[model samples]
Target: MARRGGDDRTLDLLAWQPPEPQRYAEERVRTATLRDRISRAVSETLKDCEQTRADVARAMGEWLGEDVSENMLNAYASQGREEHTIPYLRLLALVQVTGDTRLLQLGAELFDTTVIENRLKPFIEIGMRFDRRNRAVAIAQEEDREIDVAIRTIRKGARQ
Candidate 1:
């Protein structure tokens, strides 16, 4: 038998409905929204140290020498707020106040990127090899997990 390949029309015809695809699409959009992700990251970072909005606001005000109220900070973390993006300086302050990089990491992960400190841009290429090494280590970790899972399954089957 020979198979013929067609374009968009064929794909459209062959696509499966699989019940409520629209619902899945809507949910994906809801969850993947950048604003929502940032807000969630802020909330998670706060939760780690058992801090409240007021605590953050007070700490930030003291650290930055500005008056930031609890309501303003709460609005930033809450959904559908105008301040979807936190200022870079404020974000730095958040890192200092919270003592956690989760918020910055979350924003970077959401965009499939990373934040690395660089003192001199001209000398920054020297760090590429180190970054590649880190990537290799990550791949090795994933391989180790796969091997562990395989061994566990094999032992379970032998017992059965």
Candidate 2:
């Protein structure tokens, strides 16, 4: 077989072998349609609670200090994932105001219950278990326990 000019590879090696074009096109269309439907639903839901949304936006801007957009607000509302807890709490407050039960349930479901109970709670408990005065062996033991639990959870999750 003749090698291609660029890297001396055969055409069979260099040529793209994408999925069947018609199937790919159909998948793309389906994804686009689903996205459109979800967007419309969110838009309609937001419109029904425009005043609450505006309040949430204003509160988030005030809390985040003028660097937020409606899109950011929307993401915060739709998905509670955030680098900081401030946006999550603010979004929750807004949802409370709006009486949006669905968003509330979604947020509750998305909240990382396992991490909160297993990781954060244990860390805090260990911190509190050690006295400020005698902070040598007890602190070390607590820290070790926290680390062990964390490692075990990580291993378990990996296995699963």
Candidate 3:
């Protein structure tokens, strides 16, 4: 309340209760479907080049010196089976051909990293520290506001 005497206008620190922990399902991250993540990345990479799945398949097939089929590409881009996920080599080829990193980004996200690239440069970081830091600050500010509201409520209750 105060250093030593009667004018003790403390925050009534003990009167404040900490908020309850949030439930798992109520946490920030949502459970995303792998199928959707894969399909969206593939489609966005192709779409940026004004290319269809067939065109990408043909180009990638030529680059890989193997038969990457249009139907297989379609299946991969159309949310096919779990085993239908594109390999890393194919992903690199797609990034090379389309010159976009949407798929690469999804791969980075899966491994808890971020992807940064350009025509002559590429960079991958170990962890998503920046994002986590920003989120932590946001949560702290929110909690501060909640505590302010709580203190006001207690002061009001005491007055009445």
Candidate 4:
């Protein structure tokens, strides 16, 4: 294929094939509200933690340089206390203290996104590049089809 007048040589997009889809752990379809999810995450993380609620709160307070009382933590984790939502920074501190990244993953899932370790980001980037390449090839083929149709019409007009 001839190179375009750009820095990179044009690829033969027509010959390109898309990569196979990858499957990860499938999450069950949930009907819970965000508020419920947040409350559940806080409760679950606390239950799994070795530290007491007071200790977790103290660590969170220290991490944020603010007063995070055990009562406040309880309120944040209480499903009935819809108004007592955990602040973003407080949630971050809680995750840091408990090392429960699912708290962040819950939020990411709301936007159809996933939370992954830093080490795996390059592999995700590779998949993204493949998606981009597939889109480019599709667009190029469409443009080529339009050009061919136009050329055919002009040739028929000249023959008449």
Instruction: Go through the candidates in order and give each one's C-alpha lDDT.
Output: 0.66, 0.49, 0.66, 0.82
lDDT of 3 by residue, 4-77 (tens): 46546656655655442212121222326766666656755565677777788889989989898888876666
Residue-wise C-alpha lDDT for candidate 2, range 1-160, written one tens digit per residue: 4565786545654454433111112222232333343333344446667576667577656765665556655764242333322344654545455544444333343364221223355546655776553677778899999999999999999999
lDDT over C-alpha atoms for residue 19 of model 3:
43
Q: Number of the top candidate by TM-score? A: 4
CA lDDT for candidate 2 = 0.49
RMSD in angstroms, all models? Answer: 20.7, 22.9, 17.9, 9.5
Candidate topping lDDT: 4
Model 1 Cα lDDT, one tens digit per residue, 1-160: 2235754344453443333111112232245577776666555555565677689879988999988777776666666775655666777778888877656655565577755544344345756877889999999999999999999999999999
Clashing pairs in 3: none
Better of 1 and 2 by lDDT: 1
Q: lDDT ranking from best to worst?
A: 4, 3, 1, 2
How big is the positional error of residue 97 in model 3, measured in Å on the Cα after superposition? 1.3
Candidate 1 lDDT: 0.66
- After superposition, candidate 3 runs with Cα above 4 Å error: 1-31, 118-160
